[model samples]
Target chain A: MNRYSLNQATTKYWSLEDVVAASAKADLSWIGLWREPVQEYGVERSTKLVTDAGLRVSSLCRSGFFTSTDAAERQAKIEDNRRAIDEAAALGTDVLILVSGGLPSGSRDLDGARAMVRDGIAELAPYAQEAGVRLAIEPLHPMFCSDRCVVSSLGGALDLAEQFPVEQVGVVVDAYHLWWDADVYRQIERAGARICSYQVSDWVVPLPADTLLGRGMMGDGSIELRRLREACDAAGYDGPVEVEIFNQDLWNAPGQEVFDLALARYGEHVA
Target chain B: MNRYSLNQATTKYWSLEDVVAASAKADLSWIGLWREPVQEYGVERSTKLVTDAGLRVSSLCRSGFFTSTDAAERQAKIEDNRRAIDEAAALGTDVLILVSGGLPSGSRDLDGARAMVRDGIAELAPYAQEAGVRLAIEPLHPMFCSDRCVVSSLGGALDLAEQFPVEQVGVVVDAYHLWWDADVYRQIERAGARICSYQVSDWVVPLPADTLLGRGMMGDGSIELRRLREACDAAGYDGPVEVEIFNQDLWNAPGQEVFDLALARYGEHVA
Candidate 1:
């Protein structure tokens, strides 16, 4: 129970205040957050709310779209990521997840786009380390390879992460994005201390039209969540196991109900 | 155009006879066939029709669902694969593409299911070789890893194919399924003579409700078709390049129109 955290996206409809209140009332030790809501509610005010409620922030949702071909746009994205890192540091969380953007619009240069991801991360590594935050690269599923994230596998993420200091850059192992990989266990073992966050969500099929919102609640699909969590543990990751589902049905449900269901499912299927 | 083959699935609405006639009319030297339509139209009749029309059969669409958990069911699948090998030989095509089935129902044992695929292929290798048929393992995209095929990468397919003689087993390099893989080019180079089939299809975004029908025409989406074709050529695959798309819009369009577009796109984007 100490290791379980409800990511803000899982209860997306909940106000930041309500989620903090619910986590504290539920006697949870950690809560995961998203940048937009935290900024909307004022970063300092949101930080104080969680701190006063006796809850720790596990991680900030994301910050990385460094696949832009335009120099100015890419630089602006990097600057935005720096702000994200500072926000994560202010909230007292060391991890800021990154969903590297896909190929530049109207472009088919996959290798070039991936090179941009590596270069972008190289530029951000020093700034993140100084801010006491880690840029955790999250590999979206391959279906999103063209439009969402160029880094589509943990091995690819690690390839990028290994070029920098372990404290500076890390990889995220989200089950929804990675459970389909045959090499996942081996990659998890290789990840070792570089695994900054372990997010959980089920992969139900006949995926909804909007694949982004197709993630199922834990145990509702085919993922071996507990086994993955155990592999992460064996690989030296004892961080908060954040439940980060993005399903429309779950999002439409009451936040408290969804949060409670997530907690229960995590205990049964992932903890 | 000697290397161009029109896989019948791209013109799903066309009868086997119509596709054969169209391919011959278009001055194409090869045509790809699917099991259901070929079997439905009578394999011998279909074979003679294409043979007489001066069109050679490039490959057989599919024949492998070797991930069953039951002992009897596994044996039955192996027996069925033997029949498919005979059909391929009868059609005078050496390549019999296989889409290894997904995990068994109510099972999360991916490794176990994959082991079943290996064992089933092992059981069929000798029979296929004797029939002059090569089992071409087609690695479906990772999105289909849970429901369509366990072999989710060309590397994974090679890992299986290498266990048998090159004449008995080989791998299919389909652009739509493998374009997202960063290691695909290296795997293709390593494939060398193990590359039995080189398939081309573009990958469009906002995939439809049924992802199986989401493949775009050669020039309609994000894949680097010409580059992939060149890689295959460098890998010593001088065989037919099959245009295999499964778009709903294409299927709904006139078969001749779709066929003509595929031919034109192949010259522009793949050939």
Candidate 2:
């Protein structure tokens, strides 16, 4: 339970105050937060809510769609990322997740998009480090590579992260996004503490119409979650194991119920 | 035009005779065939139909759903694969594509699934080699990893392929399945002549209600088709550039028209 965390996305309808209260009441040591909700609730107020409730934020959901080809659009995204860094700092979390957006609209330049990711990280690394936050590059599944995030493998994320200081940047080993890779175990080992977070979600097939909300709760699908958690532990990551599902069904359930179910499943399948 | 191969699935409703006649009319040098349809039409009859029209079978669509954990089921798949190799030999195509089946139903043993693929390939290689057929393992997109093919990247397919004699086993580099991979070009380079066929398809987004049929015509999506085709050529794969797509919309279109469109797109995006 000490290392169990509920990423607010699993209970998407819940407010920041509600998530913090639920996590603290459930005796969970950590809660992962999204920037929008935190900002909407007022970062300072949200920060105080979690801190007062004796809960720590595991990571800030994200901010990094740097694949834009247009110079002005790219600069705007980077600017927003700067604000994300400040928000992460306010939330008292060292980790801020980054989802590198897909190929620019109508563009076939995948390599150029990946280069933008690398350049974006280089531009933001010092800023993140100065703010005492580590930007965690989250490699989404290859299915989402065309539109959501270009970094589709942990090894690919590490390729970019390795170019920065470990404290400044790292990779998030989210089992749902990465469990399919044959080289994932080796990449997780290589990630070490460069593994900023270990998020758990199962890959249930017949993905919903909105594939974004298709993530299943732990233990409900095909992932070998405990094995992944074990791999992370072996790689010297003893931090909180965040349960971050995005299923619409989970979102509709009561936040506390979702949190409780996630914790129980985490115990059964990932602890 | 000499290298253009019309993969039959792009015109799913077309008969083997129609595909052959269309390819002949289009002046395409090759036509890729599916095992079931060819078998239904009689392999010898289909072979003669294609050869009579001056269209060579670029490759046989597939075999090898050997991920079953059950012994009897596994053995059955291998025997079926043996027959597929014989059929490929009869049709006079050296490449018999393999889609390593997904994880066994309700089984979370992905590594075990991959092991089954490797072992199954090992078991069938001798027969394929005897038939003068090179088993080309096609790594489907990672989206299909759980229920379609365990092998999800060109590198992963090559890992299994390199374990066997290159002439007996090889990998298929399909643009739709592999374009998002950062290491695809490097893997293509490593694949060298082990690349048995260069399959092309475009990756369009907001995948249809049935994601399997979401592939777009080459010029309609984001994959860098010409770049990938060139990668294969650079890797010494000067084989037919097989234009294989699984779009439901394309399937419903007139076969000859689809063939013409595929040829045009092949020239514009893949040649």
> Taking chain A by itself, what TM-score does each prediction score?
0.99, 0.98
Off by over 4 Å in 1: none
RMSD, one per candidate, in order: 1.1, 1.0
Ten-residue segment with the worst summed lDDT in candidate 1 chain B?
B102-111
| Best by the lDDT measure | 1
lDDT tens digits by residue: candidate 2, B120-224: 999999988988999999999999899999999888998899999988999999989998887889999999989999888888888777889889898998888
Q: Looking at model 2 chain B, report the run of 10 residues with the lowest lDDT sum.
A: B253-262
Interface RMSD of each: 0.8, 0.9
Candidate 1 local lDDT, A4-95, one digit each (tens): 89999888989999999999998999999999999999999999999999999999988998988799999999999989999999999999
* Model 2 stretches with alpha carbons more than 4 Å out: none
